[model samples]
Target: MSKKEKSTSVNKKTLGRILKYIKRYSFLVVLSLICAAISVVLTLYAPIITGHMVDKIVGKGAVDFGALKTLAIRFVIVVAVTAVCQWIMNILNNKVTYHVVNDVRTSAYKKLEQLPLSYVDSHTHGDIVSRVIADVDQFSDGLLMGFTQLFTGVMTIVGTLCFMLSINAVITVAVVVITPVSLFVAAFIAKKTYHMFRKQAEIKGEMTSLVNEMVENQKVVTAFSMEENVNGSFNEVNKRLNKAGLDATFFSSITNPCTRFVNSLVYTGVGIIGAVMAIKGRISVGQLTSFLSYANQYTKPFNEISGVVTELQNALASAARVFELIDEEPEIAEPADAYVIEKADGQVDLSHVDFSYNKDVELIKNLNLKVEPGKRVAIVGPTGCGKSTVINLLMRFYDVDAGAISVDDHDIRQVTRESLRDNYGMVLQETWLKTGTIKENIAYGRPDATDEEIIEAAKQSHAHSFIKRLPEGYDTMISEDGGGLSQGQKQLLCITRVMLDLPPMLILDEATSSIDTRTEIRIQRAFAKMMKGRTSFVVAHRLSTIKESDIILVMKDGHIIEQGNHESLLAQKGFYYTLYNSQFAH
Candidate 1:
């Protein structure tokens, strides 16, 4: 199909999707349409009544004052009724528009939740957020404009044309002749600008992503004194967005003036034709006057609708982006009869597991491991090795490309992800805390935990001393980034969270890397207590932290180079030996 045809198809699909959300409020939409029709009919009647009142005045002395008075009263009532209907239409439109936006935003958010980790990992957080928030806002504005103006505009045009035909068909013909010019202008510009607007939306997303990245990493930029470099990168993105916006706006903006100019020509032709008919006695002067009013009304909607079309194009572009996110392929669905492991014995086995983020780049190949219940297994590897990947696979964040990972002798893929994750308590080197109180953050894993349990967990993680130092103690509010909290303090809160729920299986990936040595020792003691009688996987860079593990797996280039107890691995004097000695090399 041609490009134009493809665009038309996509736009129709987008509109169809939008209608599905609007259908939920069909009753309100119907009421709004009725109001629009009523308002347009009353508004159209005003011109006809005015013409009749004008006809009552035939050269002052022969004026029919009584008839004029009756017409005047009717005109007043029509205007008043029209105003009331228009008011009602606007109210209903706002309700439908905002509610539809809310539903779309909610669905987009829920879709994000169901999406695979790889999809999210591949996209910027800000771009995803933009689709959910900013794009939805744009769609709402466009929809509101379409509801308030587009419907009434179309109705007014039809109403006026009917009125004009009843008065004089010759003048109506003249008006119709120039109407297509306005529509053609509007359509041509709209078609040319839709792609530009889509480009603008994409660039705007990129700009949002850049801004979010800068805000989240401001400290890193400042510490590295890379502000100039970061600013340069931002400027580059800003330039592209600027050009996209300007190009989109420039094309869409011309639609209104061009259509309005054509509409003006249409009105001029009606006035000239109507006047000639009145002079020739084919129609009364008052009838000619009414025809002129109808002509103006007929052409007015074209101008208003052209503007609405421009806005609708923009809205459709944003809606498409949001829909794109909603339509993304979600994570692999679980089996129909997936097992829900409420209480796992925590025997995890990876047999011949092979995986890679990129298919061309091989990573984990034929990996195999087995962890008995209640055993503490430390996976020590260099930065790029598969330590964290193993944790991700265990939690089913990403499935293996080959082979199977089983928990308690059951294939992990065969079990429900929620239940599998419920069995494991994880703490990574990178900590994440939502905007809430310390007590709330601790109770995240178990929201029903008593305050006493939360407090005890905090104390065990050694975050209680710091909590007491704050003004509100455990109730002190913090931002999502753990504002006003040091890295160590944030890590303590994370540890406190795991300590609160104490799942049957634990995955600690450099969990103590952020805390200081003094605090680290205290948190380690807490972890040791938490790890007791629970299967644990510790991915650590600090060899001293994992020295006490029942078994240590040394990984290099995605393959296990060594696996044995600390003393046994040391006695081998291989990769594990070199890594262990390097930590205490000084």
Candidate 2:
């Protein structure tokens, strides 16, 4: 099938899955239906009572006081009952919608967690955030208002049609003639509105992303004095969003007014026809009056049906976006029969591994390496020479396109991703600390770790001193993303957090790049102590950091060109020797 056809099929499947998400709330749906039925019954009686009043007055040529009183009392009762039912329905609908929204949000987040790292790398954070916030909120409206409006509209239309036909089939036919025309108008507008709404949602997501970028990179913008440029770009996106929103609003806005106009015309025609029939002595004055009331009542339900048509279209548009996200296939997933590795000695071996982030460009090709248990292997390469890619593959962030990676005699792919990753502790180039106390950050790696264990881990990573210097030490709260801490401080806290877990294998991808040389030396010392008797892979540009490693590998163009001990490789005067000379010679 063509790509567009494939996408259409996928979207359909996604919608089906979303509908299934509502299955758990069947009870709430039933309750809503009950409430809507009650409201419809009450509303349907309004025209009947008016007809009764008209008939009584015309038949007796005077008001029937007792009968009028009874009709009035019944009308009041219906109105009060409907009011109560509507209030209860609103409460129940909100409660159910909230629960469904919570489930959707939670499920989306869980999918994010389970998704492989490549999916995250390929997708923008802003797009994902939009799905989580805006898209999900849109579904909330669909769940609460969409279902209720649709149900009530259908009921009102059916009920009104029954009563109208009962009054006079000729008048009913005249009023009902407008049904197909109104539907056509509504459907045409809804289709146009759907396109506009989808465009609006897309632009809104883009705007959100731009705002996120500006906020996250405020420092860079200030440093480069690019506020004007950023603002111009932002305004451009904002204008597009405004235009799309206006288009959608225009389409939705015309629906109700047009429907009302058509209904008015139909009602006027009904009155004229009823008058002619009454004057010809074909119908009583009472019947003519009753028909007029029913005709007016018919218009109200059609108007409601038109409104529901617009809302349902909007809901479908929103659902399409939401399903788009939930249907996205993760780039990496565990095998069906994957085994769990409870314990690992961390003997990492990469044999003839070839990998690429994209087609036609190989990031790592025919790379072979081995690190014995408890050995420290330092990987050194120039910028963009697949240094980080190695770490990514080692952590199973992205599966290798060819060859195999084995840890302790078990191929990484043969085991469940969680079990395979459980043996490793990683401190990334970018340090990210969540909003919490220093102790909490340390305990993040091992939630079950005791307070004493946390403090010891902090001390081992040389983070305890500065942490204690803070106002509340371990109890001091950190901002989201560790906004309160300096780069070095954040790095130290992240290192401490990783150390607390004491994973069997460790990957430090430029772990100390943010610290000053002196601080780097101190952190290196702490890292060395932690690295003892543990398998570790260190990716660093600094020559000083890797001097004490058991083995050093020089990589270029995704291939391991040189490998040996620091002293031996320095003596060879090859790639490693040239790299060391260049850095130290400067």
Best by TM-score: 1
Best by lDDT: 1
Residue pairs with backbone overlap in model 2: none
Lowest-scoring 10 consecutive residues by lDDT in candidate 1?
270-279
Question: lDDT per prediction?
Answer: 0.91, 0.82
Q: Can you write out model 2's per-residue Cα lDDT over 1-586, one digit (the tens) per residue?
A: 9854664574466557666777788898789889988898778777678777776777545879899899989888989999999888887778777887888888888777776777778877887788788978876776676666667777777877787777778878887887667777877787677667777778878888889888988989999999999999999999999898888888898998887888788878988999998889877776776677766666776676666666655666666776666666765666798888887887999998999998698789888888899999999989888999999899888888999999987889888888877899999889888888888888886889998888888888888888899999899999867867898899998898888888889899999999988878888888988899999999999988999999998999888888998999999989999899898895
Candidate 2 residue 71 Cα shift, in angstroms, is: 2.0
Per-model TM against the reference: 0.98, 0.94
Q: Whole-model lDDT, candidate 2?
A: 0.82
lDDT (Cα, 0-100) at 259 in candidate 2: 79
- Looking at model 1, residue 398 earns an lDDT score of 98
List candidate 1 stretches off by more than 4 Å.
Answer: none
